[model samples]
Target: MPRRTRVLLVLFSIVTVLCAWAGLMGLGRLTNSGFLPDDAPVRDDNRRLSAHYRAGGADLVLLVRADTDVDSAAVAAQGRAVGERVARSPGVVTAVSYWSAHDPALRSRDHRAALITVDLVENEGRATRAAQDLVPGLTGRQGPVTVSATGPAWASVEGMQQSRRDLLAGELIAVPLSTLVLLFVFRSLLAALIPLLTALVSVTGTLACLYALTFVMEVSVYAANVACALGFGLAVDYGLFVVTRFREERAAGAGPDEAVTRSTRTAGRTVAVSAGIVALSLCCLFTVPLGFIRSVAVAGVLVALLSAAATVCLVPALLSAAGALLDRWDVFARLRRARATGSAGAEEGAGWRRIGRAVCRRPVLWALAATAVLLAMLLPFGHAAFAPSDARVLPAAGEAHRTQEQLRRDFAIVPDRTVTIGLPRGTDRAALDTYARAVAALPGAAEVRTADGVYRGSTHHPAPAGTAPVAAAAPAGPVLTATAASGRESAEARRFVREIRGLPAPGGSALVSGEPVRVVDTTAVLSRALPPACLLAAAVTMLVLGSFTRSVLIPLKAVAMAVLSLGACVGGMVLIFQDGHLRGLLGGFTVTGTLDGAVALFVLVVAYALSVDYELFLLSRIREEYLTTGDNTAAVIKGVQRTGRLVTAAALLVVSAMVALAASGVTLLKVIGVGLAIGVVVDATLVRGILVPALMAWAGRWNWWLPGRLRRRAATGDRHALSTDEGAEHAH
Candidate 1:
């Protein structure tokens, strides 16, 4: 081994050890569901509501079911006791119960259930801790009431815990299954083990990076899940590319050192370009305002870069150490024997050559047919709708999901469906009345409430005696709120918020906020950002491919093919999840009639990146062959034949990892897993296998055409020119 390679190996080993240590120590500190953006109106409204009502926002609710009426003395007393206990728990900010509020909204219509709401400190970690600490004591039979805990605080804590377990479960399944697949593909234990080791290093390093990020800013628990799955898959892919190339060179009679050097020059360049494409594509997520998607972007880019670096640096060193030993311990000796009897050059991939010939025989027909199939799959996306995530993301059997469902069913008149309208402080009574009336007059508006009184349309109802407090000498600012008849996720509720926002406010300025408004605003943010993000991804992809292949048409074709594959994956998600098809096959989940906004965008970006990833792999080989042969048709055939099996194997490993993630109970994770899995399969088989070769064949020599300056350089016996001349002579 070279001294430089040995030194690099030592440095990487020490860094890997440190990363493992950091990952273990910081694992427990990660947060979950940090999706809300700082500048979101809902976030600001939550803060304001918490400040004003003390326990309005960020409250954990205990649903107390009783054998008799919940309003009975015994049940009420039990509820109060539970509330008081929770209030005294660590990190408790305030607590309210049906007994304390005397509000009808707190009790079920049948009076068999009531709520005790407890608020914790504003910090997510502290609130999660408090909820975890209090849940056990408060749940189950307590005196006359049967208590069950559910609320945002408990949900956050439980979700984080669930995510951690899911990550472990997924890794347990994916790592082993991926290993078996790798072993089958490589037919050598040592070769398979090298990729798995590279993945381990990449994943550990990614987790350590995320852990360090958490200390400075909130890092979602989902980051670990994304990191592990993608890190493993990418490491395996890059390793497969480099190892396969090295082996090919070795088989062609190059010495081990020459094989390693040549493979690094070709496959290493491809890995670097592929990594750049993935990292740049993920960087588009930064345009999204939500923290969760941004966290995914961070973790994904980190993993891609790390995986590429390991493949280029560490894998080569390992290969150098292994030398010819990589071919030892062949599990499938019969297949090796069969290969040895075949023709030396052409027969190595005779099957792939047949496929290439078949595709090129009628390139236009195959291209059109594939494009039609992809478009047909995309038809379901027209019916797709998006909703902001809620407790519905959890499994139906989960306490949080059950509680949310129960709340929605029983508490039909709750204020959560209401939109809070902020007004300038100290507004006159007449202006407040006009503002309330205007808000109430909006379409879908049910009622409006203000400090002055409640109003139905233009009519103001007088407050009952002693219900309205006398005006204080120095009164705090007044805020008016309007409740819609429909639930927050309903179309009517969204329309109501939008119509209200369009109405004139009597106050100097007004801000509307609630769940409905949040959905609208978040959707608006993403919609505005999507175009720019897509453009950025395209530009980056074009630059990377152009640099790698030195051809403008290949990059354009790659971008177009990636978009088609992404459409198919997204369309599949909508058909399966949103339309409620394949529920039995994919596990039961509540069809919200809409996908989560973040999940949709997350899947889109990820699917596109994976598409580009496979595209680059196939293109790199084709470009190499094209430069050598100076014959587009021959290059297309040779490249596809050479890379077809490697790409297929790598895709299987990645799809396995993603499918393991689909086994998670969390609907969002499942969506991501299934969506990306489908994307990989489609890109690997239909897109890369068929459309790429077909299109390249259709373009003929035009596939290699370059602009004036580069064309001049190519004709002057450059490296590419020399390769072309040598290839022509070899063919003769």
Candidate 2:
């Protein structure tokens, strides 16, 4: 065997063993965690209590309305029959109907409407079956009842089920399409298979890790879906980088082993640097407050890291082991070899001489134009507001949303804020009376009913402190209850929270516990975390590129391009989503002014890494030309021309995948997909093709200039610039 082949095979075997062991270990850890499907609503305390009160109460909610009246003999009988059937469900905990409560209004004022609450089995798979059973049975034209399923149970069971299907649809579409693109790009099944295998193994391993994460942290149901998308997408992208370079080297008359070595050393470095940047960017999510957002960042980082490692380590080994058999399935081998038979281009210095001559001709004009354009694209983002979505997070077409809309329209309620202020189960009557007045008098106070030892308002419903619904009789003293509005001033809600925090303990017993408060707390945490994460990612990118190019200016250029790419992507998404251009196509979801907290962070990270891919591609070629010719101009032109086609192809494939995601009914998915896709296009064509080259052409030798200290350090050990006469000729 050739020495290079021997080296690659040995390295490949070692990494293969390591990856297998790691995958097995990760799986072992995953197996220990409980299997709660992604959409399970076991997190809410009320839902948990409801579940305990009636098993599966958190998974199945039935809303039955009568247009005429719920109390009529016909309506009552219908309600009873429905309740009885629901009660007999295999996993039902309890059934509640208007007749069951004897509340006239609960039956609806016109006597036409009533609600049926059916709690199902707690297990997610069982809950799903029972919930689905309730929906079809309750719908009918003749019956007075118009039944709709709503609440955490329905979301957890039904919404989750649909989400899984949508995700599967995205994956099924992405995998095959990506494979075709890979086959075209590599011209061989063997080369394509290496990356595909790496993607599959990495994805499976990431999922197993995600399953294991449930033990150390809370993982969102959506996190798994995102992992598959990001992990596989990144895998394909990284695989493309490595595989393309390996083939390029081989076609240049390098042996299989030599090609693997060259590909690993050159393209592998770029993949590593880019992956690190991507992971670091994703880790920025740790600064956000929501567990869902944090989980996405964590999962994405894990997957990106693994994908990068696989591309650099696993792929090389596979290439080494397969040798020429790797290209055996390539239909274009003869054509490709024939193309390579042509004479090489000008030497390094000669090409650079021509490029430098052209650039020095009009440096000022080129620099001014590039800066002005990028600044204009970045301007729109200043108007961008980070708005959290409420409705779109749930399934687009669902009962919860319909019910929520109805509730909002009829009652003037905002479903965004659901909170409860907790008081001890038993408290002093005097303190309760005082607190009730204080809550009722608040500026945003809507209607506060102080019956049943609880204050109930239209706004604050969680653990309501007012009467037990208007139907239930009032409770005696030592009971806690209340509800209030979101507050008139908008800031009033936040101000009220502050007031509540400052209020005298009222016998040292009152505490506030609710989702809103949790959100506020989480936001604080996120605000502190985001900046550091961004800086860290930027630092890493700068360091890696600086090391690779041994050029201070090029690293700075890469960072600038990355930032511009992010701004362009986010700005375009804001236009598409916040502007509501595709609302109808995306299941009629209203684009909130801003993206979800988690989605924005993730899209930003992904965009940054994508920009880095182009940066590295261009820089690798440019630096190679520079070292050989000692002329920056020639390097810029030759480098752009050489990598331009590959970059364009990669961008197309990536953007296509992103556009596919944008077609999803899920609003967040659509926004993220469109944003990322648009960003890749902008980076690949506009920034990489035009802006980067123009800037380099203007900078001349300064493009490769490093400070004295850094230059000496790079000279000692980290020399990435390889400028040989043959290499220059081939590049040209």
Candidate 3:
């Protein structure tokens, strides 16, 4: 081994060990935070409401299922007791129940259940701790009623727990399965192990980086799962490229050191470009202004960069150490020997070569057919709908989801969806009353309540004596709460909030705030940010690909291909999750008629980057072959033959990890997992195998064309110099 390589190996080893330790130490302390952006308007409104009304909404809720009538004295007494116990619990700010409010809406329509709403102090960590402490004591049986606890605070804690379990389960399934796939591909145990080790190190290092980030800013619970899956996929991808190239070099008669050097020069360059593409694509998430999206981006970028670093610095050193031993301990030694002897020039992908030749034989026909199929797949995305995350995102069997469903089914009012319009403080009773009446008159508005009374569709009803609070004591402002006729996720509810916001304020300054408004605002933010994000991703991808390939048309074609694959993936998500197709086969989630907006955006960005990832792998090899042999057709055929199997193997490994994520009980994670898996499969099979080869064949020598100055330089032999330097830099 070279002295420089040995030194790098030692440096990387120390860093890897430190990262592993930091990951372990930080894993347990990672908190589930950053669900909402700090600067969101809805957050400010929620804060104002909490301060003024002493109601932080329902942080915890106890569902009291009565054996007999819910309104009966026994059931009422039990409900009150449960409410009082929760109110007295540490960190609880207030509690309300059917007994305290005497509100009929708290009682189930079947007269078999009632609800107790508890508002905890507005500290996430403290509130979660208090809620956990109170759960055991408050849940189960309370006199004649069976008590079950759930609400935002409890759900937050449970969501974090569930996410951790899902990550563990996904890794358990993905790691073993990925190992088997790698072993099958390489037919050597040592070769198989190297990629997994790199993945572990990269993922652990990313976790450590995320943990450090948590101290400075909130990180989402979902980031861990995303980081693990992406880290594993990217690490294995880079490793596979490097190792496969090394073996090919070795098979072509290079010594171990020379093989390593050549493989690093070629495959290492592709890995660097691929990593940069992924990092730049994820950086688009920063434009969305939501913590959850930003956290995923942060974790993704960390994993991609770290994986590339390991691939370039660590994997080569390991390969140098392994030398000729990489081919030993093969589980499929006979097949490996057959492969080595049967194929000349290390072009072992005869099957892929045949496919590429077949496509090139009728390039126009193949390209048209593939493009038509992709467009047909994209048809469903035209009807795609989106909703913000909510309790429905959890499993149906979960307590939080059950409570949410029960509330929706039994109660006339949806508290979470109820929009609160805050008028100026000291607003007169008549002005508040007029505002309430106007809000009630809006379409889809069920009822509007103010300190004066309740109003329905322009009709005012005075509150019972002493029920209406005197306006003189109003501190934060006079509030009119409007309950939507439809559920929060419904278009009617969203429209209602929008219409209400468009209405003239009685006090000349009113803030409309609630779950529906939050959803609307979040959607709006994402919608506004998406165009710029896409532009940035495209610009960065074009720049990176142009730099790597030095061809304008190739980068443009690559970007278009990425968009096509992403469109198909989005269409598939809409068809399966939103349109409710294949629900029975893919874990029967309640087809909520809409995809989570955040999840959809996340899938688009990540999947596009990954699609581009494979493109770079194939195109870089093709470009290299063309530069060397000066024949575009032979270059395309040989490039596909050389890299096709490796690309498919990497895709299989990534898709396997993604498919494992489908086992998660959370609907959002399931959608993301399934959607991403589908994307990889499509990109690997149809896009990479068929479309790319056909398109390159049809483009011919034009695929390698450069502008005037670059063309002159290439003709003068600067191209080789540039490519060599890029390969060396990326290799180390």
Query: Candidate 1: which stretches are off by over 4 Å?
Result: 1-11, 52-59, 85-94, 118-137, 334-346, 414-416, 422-441, 446-475, 478-481, 713-732
Worst 10 residues of 2 by lDDT: 28-37
C-alpha positional error of residue 715 in candidate 1 after TM-score superposition, expressed in Å: 5.6
TM-score of each: 0.91, 0.75, 0.93
- Cα lDDT tens digits, model 3, 208-276, are 998898788777778888898888888988898899989988876777887888788778978988999
**What TM-score should be assigned to candidate 3?**
0.93
Candidate no. 1 TM-score: 0.91
- Please give the RMSD of candidate 2 to the true structure: 7.0
- Report every candidate's CA lDDT: 0.80, 0.62, 0.82
Report the number of clashing residue pairs per model.
0, 36, 0
1 versus 2: better TM-score goes to: 1
Residue pairs clashing, model 3: none
2 or 3: which has the higher lDDT? Answer: 3
Best of the candidates, lDDT: 3
